[model samples]
Target: MKLARIYNVQFGKRIVTVKPDWLRVKAPQWERVGNVKEILRDLTLNTVCEEASCPNIGECFKAGTATFLIMGPACTRACPYCDIDFEKKPKALDPTEPARLAEAVRRLKLNHVVITSVNRDDLPDGGASQFIRCVEAVRTISPQTTIEVLIPDLCGHWEALELIVQGQPEVLNHNTETVPRLYRRVRPQGNYERTMELLQRSRQIAPWIYTKSGIMVGLGETNEEVRQVMRDLRAVDCDILTIGQYLQPSQKHLKVDDFITPEQFAAWKAFGEELGFLQVVSSPLTRSSYHAEEVRGLMERYPRQKVIN
Candidate 1:
């Protein structure tokens, strides 16, 4: 794919360069999107698709899929690269959220679902109890639906992580977000070592649950740096990886250091596969939970024995 040269674009009051043609997303069926949104609204649920302003929201919603953002939309940490709102003292957890989320899953008839959350650092267990409740609710309402939880580091609370692992979601994902070198700049509140330890411990706690992590490019990290992150993830036996170009969410957020090419993404995909990642989704528009439903097929191919703890 030929990269479209720099073109001045208007983002609110700021003039930033527009994304290349290869990154452009075709309009989705709004009617389908509306149907999904209606279901979410009826349940009073929030999705990362709308919260984080994901570029692929339309496509995902049109396809009757969404990454459910649980807990609350307000994150405790303010990662500039992210668009999710931050709140020092977010409202208390709603006990009814789990049932409502399950109802949405049953209504959508989802074969697979991704349940993620904001960084509820205020919670002692980093909202692990809520995650467990949500998973149980989904299993009750939609027994056949496979579940994936993209969670936070839980302030390096291994016990909390073990609790989530014991819940036995088909997959557990935590995004590395960027290379270690740029951690302070890109993810000031996140710890590189903590992220790796979390994934490593997830596998240790429950090997049957697939461990997944993601990284975003265009944040001024070198290709070698990205490969290093991949190697680190593999060191923890991460099963799935996602690499995507970082599009600045707003003028106040971090600027895009570079626009990675599709060729480079393809190269990274090849590299990740060579390093033994069971699945690697690499593209300019890829996100952590993008096409998460496909994991059901992966599960069938690489079946795992559920560990009884």
Candidate 2:
């Protein structure tokens, strides 16, 4: 099998081997990044930006925005493609976390916030209660801020999903991660059917809360397979979608099978929009929570009235 060549570009004195020119992220203002990091540290908060080794961390932190990672910096599942630490017996849930997260939001004075957690399969509610707590805490401190929870599948605990939906966040996101054909090798513990069911149930339970999911390319998936995943998401009435290129975190993790070009990402964006997604953010550097604040505009554009039961 022929492997794709990694491209190297010299930056002043340093030569870095990045996948493509399109993947290059500009250096962010470190002073601003440090300010955000200092706030997070002072509040004892964790963010997915740092835990996942996301390439856009500089951009996000510098912009004074971050995806608050509650429940832990340690995930229960050991998905090979992910960079988050895997711990079988992580620490007990911190009761102070929610308030601290809210403090961070207040200090940041953000108009929108994204809160996500590691897979806490060890917990009975799959950390759904924690999500509710965080959402409520943020609302208490920053009522003007819209909340988006990028959550786990809850190990198929429908009741827990109901509790979260009842919290009434502005958006509920559970990433499909990859095409169905790649689920076994890519996600291992993740079930494609369950992902679809979770998104479908979120829509059914709370049509007012936007349903969002994301997938990564350059992982040996065919274009048609990616398109089919979009179709599946739309069938479940998922409202927002994000598509991005997968970069190998380290040699220990999954190797990048290909480098998806900018043109390909643009094509996927167009296809997702045509499929009736209220918003489609597709680019080589796009992540599930990248520019997540934009959802505030989406909520205004497509306002959903809460259903009275």
Candidate 3:
């Protein structure tokens, strides 16, 4: 059930379809977009929406929701696929960041907030303390708001991971952005097994907290490879899965091998659910935290009693 649109581009001698019609997103309204921009500007907060150039920024902003990016905007890892600035030595963690983020949440009147940060490899805790502080501050300022933390792997730092699980966010997401074979090139700092370990161990530590992960297609991965990754995720008891089409940020980044069709995205959703994922959000436009707030509510409706951590 895709829309009627065809995208063809001339790379050199070949005309390639980079994006299909269904992948074309509607323009975001100015008023709602400006309101979100003004709030983040006034509060001095960063959002992954603007940082990552998310396609749904307008729609999400119009709906009065945003995924807040905390810590500094600079990342330690220089993943070519990523657009976040690389800093071998990013600035020291901001003590006031947590409170400021809480203030933004209070003003936005958000019911759910997704707090993500750049990789702070230099820190002893891998920036887990900042995440905890932000969560606590938000609870203090707006207890009604549920929290989700989109975290990095912390380079397999179990102690850091322990602090985060203990913080008890509604969702803990660490994306395995590509397949194992491609990890050497796409995510050289990341390990597929370690990513699995993070999700599996989180469930063990806080069984009540939902574990989630996401991956991008169109990076020279086969359909079978994608399914295998889903199987690996399920083995770790990951509760949620998100699959999306990968768009290259620049010419220096990896080229899009193919644009996955809407039909294929829908099929993956069905297959992942069949394999035991509690829920799956799959589409060309899906990202790690796409429609994050609504996804929480959908899962919460069929409540599972969680063991108090």
Highest TM-score model number: 1
User: Which scores better on lDDT, 1 or 3?
Assistant: 1
Choose 1 or 2, whichever is better by lDDT: 1
lDDT of 3 by residue, 13-68 (tens): 76555667767799989898899899899888999888877878888999889998
Candidate 2, run of 10 with poorest lDDT: 1-10
lDDT tens readout by residue for model 2, 1-309: 113456767989765557667788899899999999999989999999998999999999888999999988889999999999895467899999999999999999898899999999989999999999999999999999999999999999999999999999989999999999999999999999999999999999988989999999888999889999999999999999999989888768897878888788889899999999999999889999999999988888999898867
Worst 10-residue lDDT window, candidate 1? 1-10
lDDT (Cα) of model 3: 0.87
The pairs that clash in candidate 3 are none
User: Sorted by TM-score, highest first, which candidate order results?
Assistant: 1, 2, 3
Full-model lDDT, candidate 2: 0.91
Candidate 1 CA-lDDT value: 0.93
Better of 2 and 3 by lDDT: 2
Model 3, residue 192: distance off in Å is 0.6
| RMSD of model 2 against the true structure | 3.2
- Choose the strongest candidate by lDDT: 1
Backbone clashes, candidate 3: 0
